[model samples]
Target: MSNITWSFADRVVAITGSAIGMGEGAVETFAAAGASVYGLDVDAKRGRAVAERTGSTFVECDVTSSAAVLAAFEQIATRHQRLDVLINNAGGFWEQNTTESISEIEWDHVIDLNLKGVFLCARHAIPLLRQSSAGRIITISSLAGQTAIYQSSPAYAAAKAGVLSLTRVLASELGADGITSNAIAPSAVLTERIKVVRSAEERAATAASIPLGRYGGVDDLVTWMMFLASEEGGYMTGETIAVNGGRFMS
Candidate 1:
């Protein structure tokens, strides 16, 4: 990530799934850069703790629930009246199953969390984003969305692919409003969840396969996110930046 510094002073930034991993890193990074950050997540305890450490606001929210999403954005609107950046970072899948092996409930849950949540957040964030001179919508997607390089939850991959499509839709619809919508598709990011889900041997093997010869840290992805939210990134939209250490090239 280097020593690259971005000043988001006076900017109002909202990030979903801000309790842990990449989301939590973003909350701290943005807050440190002088932005007024709101960290939203379903885990109230960890969310609040992250907020306290970063000096940002914490809103308990489930991005999957329309009502909860509305309320969370409402709170942001009441406080800032506008938002400069919206980071759709809340998403995950529990079971790794084939398409046919996956149950309906599991499928729905993954889709809702990874895909629908982005839609809901962006849907409500558009108005507030319009108030900013250069509104930015940055979504976190997965390499699984781009390709089936390895075994993964079928629903997770599908949902992430949907996110990429939705990013373009938002960009197309909001271009006139000066809102730039983009997505970051990352792989081999060494988050806490990755540590739990993959055995050490699995992690090592994945790392070796990457051209960079290592797994990416949270900052690897978050740094690109910061760039997309920065003024310099305002000119670009509807594009997906692949940050996978050359693991999968398009």
Candidate 2:
């Protein structure tokens, strides 16, 4: 690890799905970096609590609803006037069934959350991000998007693939405007959610499979996010940084 530190002083960063999990981690990370952070999530109570704890602002917004997304961005714009970094991290994988076993509702829900949500947030964040000298759009994707994973649902894989494509397009289109777009695709991250779901043996097996002999953590992601949002990372765009402990190489 480099001894150098990255600063976000006076920067404004916006994150989606900020109530818990990785989103909450981002709030803490950015706030610690001296950035004014704003977190958006449908879980008002938890989101507000997280914001208060992390010294960030929280907005109640559902990524699936375009109206809610627009309204939230409008509020951010009103308060901050500019957004330096926008992280699209609001997504979930509920139904991990095979194609034949998955229902239409399940498919739609997964697609809406993982894929459409990225579009909704990006659509509203562009103008504000463009105003910043070092604008960044960093999205959360999955290893499943690049290749089929046994534990993931078809919808999740497809939606994440869509996110990568959208990221590339944003990078190409927004590069001229001094904006950079990128993504992070993590695998077997040992979040609290993962701890609850995976048995110790399963986790051990997973860890063994990875060359690093351990699962990734929120800090692993935080490192990449901070780097991409920093001045030193200005040259990187349309790239997906895999924080999977070398589990999958591309």
Candidate 3:
């Protein structure tokens, strides 16, 4: 039998969007498994509180801004000396009356936060991640990244699609550096924002659509993340694990 214990005893993991929901859960889980976790979020209060509770570090960061992302990465180096994992989970939805009604500013914000933020964070975190013996970059894509779904807006869909593309490119490009890039495409999950957006009936309808007959929880996604971040996942790169409860399968 395999001893599937995820112990990052001397490892550092930097998770963006780590203030709440999936990010917050991951912080707690990873920390419990012996990882030195660091969180980056625009919401400093929630971020710091979560970090304190989990014994992780929190850094105030607006992922959409390159200046903030770079500064956060610099601080990570100073504190932990090296970084092992980068979870690019910062994203949001934006649209106007329709695709036609979307302003240039609106379009930019969605793309910047969803797509550009991942690029910026990975770019800045690369130096430190590369220093680790087994470096992993895990980006959070969605069912929107895989196929057209009515859940997210147009810009969010496009940016998440770009995240998948970036994952493949980086995996190939960074292979020699011993750095692996992968993505997780999660289906509808019952998170705080999701609870507000989806009613009980609507959620039931969506869950019924999945072959698994349920929504994939945060833990479902975290299990894959833990796998990809582990040393055993060295050869498993450039892949996107879908945690949609078989919502849309290939």
Q: Which structure among the candidates has the greatest lDDT?
A: 1
The true-versus-predicted C-alpha distance at residue 95 of model 1, in Å, is: 0.7
Residues 45-83, model 2: lDDT tens digits: 999999999899999999999999999999989988989
Error of 1 at 9 (Å): 0.5
TM-scores of the models, in the order given? 0.98, 0.97, 0.95
User: Which is better, 1 or 3, measured by lDDT?
Assistant: 1
Q: In lDDT terms, how accurate is model 3?
A: 0.87
Model 3, which residues run further than 4 Å from truth? 1-4, 94-97
Off by over 4 Å in 2: 1-4
List, residue by residue over 24-95, the lDDT tens digit for candidate 3: 888888888889898999999999999999999999999988899989999989987789999998787844
RMSD of each: 1.0, 1.7, 2.4
Candidate 1 segments exceeding 4 Å error: none
lDDT comparison, 2 vs 3, better candidate:
2
Q: Indicate the worst ten consecutive residues by lDDT in candidate 3.
A: 94-103
